[model samples]
Target: MTSISTTSSPATPTTVASAASKRVADRIAARAGDPDITLRERVALRTSDAEVTYAELSERAQKTAAELSALGVGAGDIVGVRLPSGPGAVAAMLACWHVGAAFLPMDASAPDAHRDHLLSRSAARAVIDGDGPRSLTDAAPSATGSPKGDDAYVIYTSGSTGTPKGVLVGQDAFAEHTTAIADLLELRDTDTVLQFAGLGFDVAQEEIWPTLAVGGTVAFLDSKDRALGPAELARRVRELNVSVLQLPTSYWRLLCAQMRGTESPGLSFDGVRTVVIGGEAAGTKDVHAHRDGPLGHCTLVNGYGPTETVVTCTAFVLRAHEPLPPTAGLPIGGPVGERRLYVLGADRRPAAGDSPGELWVGGSPLAEGYLNDPQRTAERFHADPFGSASGARMYRTGDLVRRHRDGTLEFLGRLDNQVKVRGYRIELDEVERHLTDTRGVTAAAAVALDDGTGTGGRILAAALAVTAGGPTAEEIREDLRGRLPSHLVPGLIRVRDALPLTTSGKIDRKAVAAVLADEHTAGEEAGAGVRVRADADAASAGIAAADTADADLTLLLKLIRTLLRAPDFGPDDDFLAHGGDSLVALRVSGTLREHGLRLRPSDLLTAQDARAAAVRMERS
Candidate 1:
């Protein structure tokens, strides 16, 4: 799946703003060449029951916008949007855009703790919900005409560093980048774009505005239906005649699974134009391969971008036989029209050709800064060393990239405390945040170590002291399950007597990694550890053999060790005295699944300890 690009080749694209509205909308109108056009595209949505039109979408967006205004939502006010993807989420986004308000989208599926942190951190004037936030304010003056920069909104990332930080994107930034996307992709009014990515995800920016701005139609797929598998997705695409499809690499894998020779096994993009794969690298191998099959007539572009920049900093189309070089893809093409990019080195020196450097994004599309957190803003958004003659500020991407011998750019790797897991960038602090939230926890710390994934080992937590009724390792994990996405959660939760800190008072990550290495090595007495004649317990032994009795004893031992989180606890350990939690019990059950074992995530939590849990597992 190594498909990240090194540099952006596209120059920034800009368009003259109309007398009213916002920059993104303005750019779309100009490119569309038809202000009178009611819908962005000419596609119709169909299903077993009925057919839908863009007019319906317009009515809903307009209605929602009007409703929001009555609720005191004005241009520029930070609105924390945490909701699922569907017609409601789509309408809310367009409604926000229609009135020229900035958008701040958060993943609705995240844990409550994460959501609470985001809302508080962003200090959003208002938070949008289909059911409305628990609190509300009186109506404010309704904006009648165009929106200004001060009125624009910004979306915040689920701060993996500890809390969420808002990325302030305004009307101008949206317009600047999208206009180039339209030109680069040749998006037209006849195209129907499917909005599959979560509003919290950047792919929405690429999927939503480009189509709507061009007077093209946008279709919001229901999340429920979205999980129905690829065959069903093909039906929706063909029925809607979706011309432009943009999806995250995760979703692409599922979609690709259902696809057959150059086309979907049961369907084809008869009217589709382009298929966009972005957010994360779409493995160069997949891109090069899928370019021709069912994609027959469609153009396939593997794009790249980071959270700090506008939607996309760069992109490259996969051409037959002329695939991207091994380093990554070509640079984002010449400022698609209004924006520009600079590859700066460690000292912020603009790197020469093929020279690696930090990616600094500048131009009119830049964000003002992080919401509420000035220190972070100062660190990331630096002054224009070239001078403020252009009033241009650049965001340090922390991504190592370089220019190609040609004009294209290539991605190197990360230079900071960030790493991507299952396509999501995670900060070690975010993991610590969730751990500290657990009861009985005094101080928690995490570190990324050597793991199979290229990003590094990842943030694993260790609690130094336990508060009265302090949480167990499993409790911390379960807590995170509700606040962060699964991928952001650590693969292992190590309970320690205490965390090690440096002279500077920061968590000693090195000390934590050492613990992790010891834990994995000590616990893994891998292979056939015991002679189990029965198919019973293999939990404690970390050993599995074909013989039933041999596996049973091993499973029992493994379950006890896992539930206890005590390296020396052994198979005879008393689960309760060992401090077992529900999550640890669940792990015991999950391990069974690896060898065809299944117990509920709460299995161990209900039991007193390993022996009892083993009894339950054996019974089940």
Candidate 2:
């Protein structure tokens, strides 16, 4: 099928189905200002190992569509996309769309527990995964579970209530999303991009399809290379000579660190071009670093969007030394296509320029609501009462922001349990969802509690369960590793017999907070005073903390809670159980190494409570 153009914008792609699916493949091939580019850099996917040509991919996708049709999947069926990034993943997704099915993209790198949870919750008819391009050719009636939202992918995001809520995005949204970036990023037929980020991340929405729409080369890195250290990533960028590279803030941080203060390898990149650095909020620190850093020729663009609004609702091309905030923040720019951004105050009235308010986005790009989640959908989305249409809906992004007089929007943090760590908006409840899926995990609650330490709060996780030796925190983590991304994983885990609940039989988060405070205080009391653990010479060495015994687990838990700057914590409390999460876990782990734990963040998270953690420590 070919992409259609809309009347409103000369660039908008059509939502009409193509009579022949080859049109989608040709659409990418035809974008060349010069149709003379070689096929190796055109339709085929180049990995570190093998390659898949566009013609082969198109044929395979068509065959896969036939297979899906044989299984009774047709137009208007929502197919949950739970696949790794590769030619196969691309083929499977296109095949679903070929038959008029919607493609919901999620990270397969996530803990399988989370992936499975999304499948069941979204009521997706069947999951389209990597092998589906070839494996599901034969019918398995059982695979067809339930269907919602006709012929388009409905990605289920995390809800404040901790349930995975599905958002119905049409092919029209995908077409527009691809069109916007293809024009904005200036993707051409010759561009060769390295698709390094997780397929599930919202940024990939801009990374993958737009290049495909423009008939550019997309190189898929091995999952291992994706997790590689800074030097390795820089080397890959040099080796691939990737023209357009899209990454999250975290990955960019690592690369910028390595590429800075180094001599250029002077590698030849015949086709390299622009770099789209998006997926999270970045600072002038990164912007400054990137401009002067190794990846010199590329430009860094900041994107802002809550998932409900379909990836980024705004974009900004950051010029160097252009005024930046102490928070290292930049503007999210303006609305794309016909999208309108309204900053509304608490009273639901539109906020004036420079006034902070909840960001309400409306217009053609708005997705249909969460599948099977009417209450939440009503809470988050509503009829634009102030607008002309009688039934027009606008998504209420529980984000706090101020509208600049220039009409650009700056991002503030989330108003709900949602958090934007490294640019991904994650629901704390989703971590709990994975915890529930683990063995020996009964009634688990994870929260972002401050350990009476640091400038802001750290994450704390608490769980109540009944089982032999209960599951070791590491074992529990093994389960989480399979279902969630690195950012969403909890740092610490507390195992309890039962979680505190309200009389309504719901988790009382505040009550749990009190438990963390009481225990944190007790732990602090155990080690209220920092003593003379360092020798005269050791102290003179200017070491932060000298010995292991000083920061013992009880003392360490006390110290961890203290270091995180929490109000209180005890031996029975958890660093993550109270409030520490994946990101905070990194800081704690780094601090402990300085104090002499000689441990990885994994060690702190897997160990039992403070006392048991002490026993597991090595004597130096």
Number of the top-ranking candidate, with lDDT as the measure: 2
Taking the tens digit of each residue's C-alpha lDDT, what string does model 2 give over 1-620? 11111112222223222312323334643432233545533455677777666666667778878987876776666566777888877877777876766666778757677676766655556776655632233333322223332334566666666566777665555565666667777788677788876777666656667777767767887754434434345566666557777776655654564456656454222244555565555655666567556665555566677667777666765444344443446566667655667788989998865888988887656666666567877888888765554455688888888766556667776787766555556787776766776787777776655444322234445554647677866567655655566556665555677778999999888887678666655655543432222232224323234454533543455445545444345555555444444334455544454465544444455555544555566543
Model 1 alpha-carbon drift over 4 Å, by segment: 1-52, 98-100, 132-135, 138-151, 158-161, 225-236, 250-264, 267-273, 281-283, 286-298, 328-336, 387-389, 448-469, 485-487, 499-506, 514-620
The regions of model 2 sitting more than 4 angstroms off are 1-26, 29-41, 128-151, 257-259, 264-280, 320-328, 386-391, 430-445, 449-488, 495-620
Candidate achieving the largest TM-score: 1
lDDT by residue for model 1 (1-620), tens = 21223333322232324311345544433433434554433333333344444555556667877876776666655556777765566556667766556556777766667666666655555667867532234322222122352434566664646776777765566666677688778888777888777667776767777776666667766544424334455677877668788866545543453253534355565666777766544455555446545654566666767767766767766544454556534344333344456788766778877778887776555666776577998988877665333456767788887766556656667787776643566676776776676677777666554332222222233444566666776566666666665556665567767778899988787887787766645543331222232233344345455655445545656545533334455455545344443223333554564565544434454455554555555432
lDDT, model 2, position 216: 70
